[model samples]
Target: MNNDSLSAKPHYPILDGLRGVAAIIVVTFHLTEPLGTGHLDILVNHGYLAVDFFFLLSGFVIGYAYDDRWHNMTIGTFFKRRIERLQPMVVLGMVLGAIGFYFTDSTIWPLIHTIPLWKMLLVLLIGCTILPVPLALDIRGWQEMHPLNSVGWSLFFEYIANILYAIGIRKLSKTALGLLVLIAAVALAHLAITSPAGDVSGGWTLNAEQVRVGITRTMYPFFAGLLLSRTAKPTHIKHAFLGCSFLIASVLYMPRIGGTDHVWMNGVYESVCIIIVFPLIVYLGASGVIHTQAERRICKFLGDISYPLYLVHYPLVYFYVAWISNHQGVTLVQAWPSALLILLGGITLAYASLKWYDEPVRKWLRTKLG
Candidate 1:
């Protein structure tokens, strides 16, 4: 690797900024989770869709960055670049989660004290590799692949998507890729529509059904994003950042559709959001132009911290959720101040992690690998 190899094509700044917007929404979504009685009542009702949005963005970015450069970049180089970009924050997120694990003692996770220190450390080690843990080893009793940071489950699948792109799918004809996206879209719709919950939500477990959910969730959005990057003929969209961001918020912040009597309504909503709306937003965001220094700086900061923020915020949410569980009758109004503090603190930590840890570590890694 040399300077030439390290040089990257220009980014869709608005898309990066949108990622940060979605990551913050995800944080708020988790922050408010303990307030809700169930899926239908959550304040940020459709925030889980942000993960699908991220997958779509990942695919589009991947296609833009590597699709045509395969002639020059080896698979090793591609993986190395991805690792340099992603792994530092990931390792720090796991360490932070592990450090906070035992302190979050509440009835919600009563078994926390019973788990041995070595077991927690072992799980942390496995989590660093982005591998799923077995249910039997679930120290937090959450049955999550990465119990310390529940968000790691999505990252696990994200890595799988990356590997698939690097291995063979990137070589597929545009028509073949489009067909794959179509089939995946159908699978995703069926999963959402038929689910008892009537939403595309459960992908943090190791069981067969959850795995199917995870894969189905991963396939359509990510593949559609890839297809979009290849096939979309983006045009100038004035104020695209503002417009696209609003579109994303409007869709993701939507109320849960088809309540207890009709889960399928919500299913259709989620499918339509993922299959249709997200791609359009990405296209618009890609087509956007940034005209001012302030806008550029804002997008840069958001893009820089988006991944770190997404990876690290959940550990804090775990503690917050536990606190909420301990005080069951507390209303969201009573809890708003604390939730706001966590949101601000998560952003600060993500920035600190980026400047002091993520940036430096990535630089060092790139130097060494280069």
Candidate 2:
């Protein structure tokens, strides 16, 4: 698989559609987060795991697209392609977050008024670079590196993974990559099992522990995904998309496995899901093919908007969370309609941004830089 041949390889549509599905689940997860008190009671119990799934998908896709192309693609070229593919939404999400910041004034984040406009602009500028801000500069009080768009933290780690691949990982032999993945798997399991919260969750902060969590979370599945891409042979599989979707939903929706007394049990569950199940799902998705025009269109649409939807939905989520916080007694039943509106609004906004803003920006960049 030389660079030119690999570059011409067709996309795995099922994998793209599955990514969209996970993105939608993340939106629902955030929307429902306020409805419950803890992981056990949350509506979408495993929604946070979508980030891990995303990391795995990204690894596989990157390997498929560029592992061979590295012979011709310089590190500079690789970084530019990634930035062009990803940075537009990052900027838009930050801008949208800043725009919605003041409107999210509620009991939850009451100090929005105290934060100066210049500080907010500064944070937005920093966020545009996908760099994590420290606690000293924390304006939103959530301690998120990108307080405006908290999701940008994942993108920060994502860039790290890309840099690693470009610099050295792409050149490693399968045996060496396997050893790295094994070591990462152990670190991930340790992090998951020992976490105070009994899950692999806190990667958004810029502290030492959270940075470890972010990197640990990134290494295993991402490299596992890369390893899988190099070794696995895709075979004919029936209903692979549906089966993989069901598997993902089952893993995510599974109830908290262990109570506070047996916290490590749940940690093991999360580790196993991330280390073992997620790669299986990606493999299944990549092996499957769309059999109908309807399925193809659906997958195409979902694939097209998945990235925008993931990046853009959270600012609106901030507004919705604040709205719910302001009205304390509202039940999920009472707020279902509003929740539907938020979901629909996110989808509409994502589609519009994709068609109007992201596509044009990328096209222009490609024309100038390609």
Q: Give one digit per residue, the lDDT tens place, for model 1 in 23-137.
A: 8999989988888999989999999999999999989888877799899999999989888877787789899999999999899999999999999999999999889999988
Instruction: Name the best candidate (by lDDT).
Output: 1
Candidate 1, residue 338: Cα displacement in angstroms equals 0.3
Clashing pairs for predicted structure model 2, backbone only: none
Candidate 1 regions off by >4 Å? 1-8
Query: Which ten-residue region of model 1 has the weakest summed lDDT?
Result: 1-10
For each candidate, the alpha-carbon lDDT, in order, equals 0.88, 0.87
For candidate 1, the TM-score is 0.97
What TM-score fits each model?
Answer: 0.97, 0.97
Q: lDDT by residue for model 2 over 1-370, one digit each (tens)?
A: 0011133687788887888888888898898889988877788888899899999888888888888776777999988888889888999999999999988988988788799999999999999999998887788888899999989999999889888988999999999999999999999999989988889987899999889899999988788888988988888777887888788888877778788788889899999999999998988898897888898888878888889999999999998889898999789998888889999999999999999999899889989888
Poorest stretch of ten by lDDT in candidate 2: 1-10
Q: RMSD, each candidate, Å? A: 2.4, 2.4
- The list of candidate 2 runs beyond 4 A from truth reads 1-7
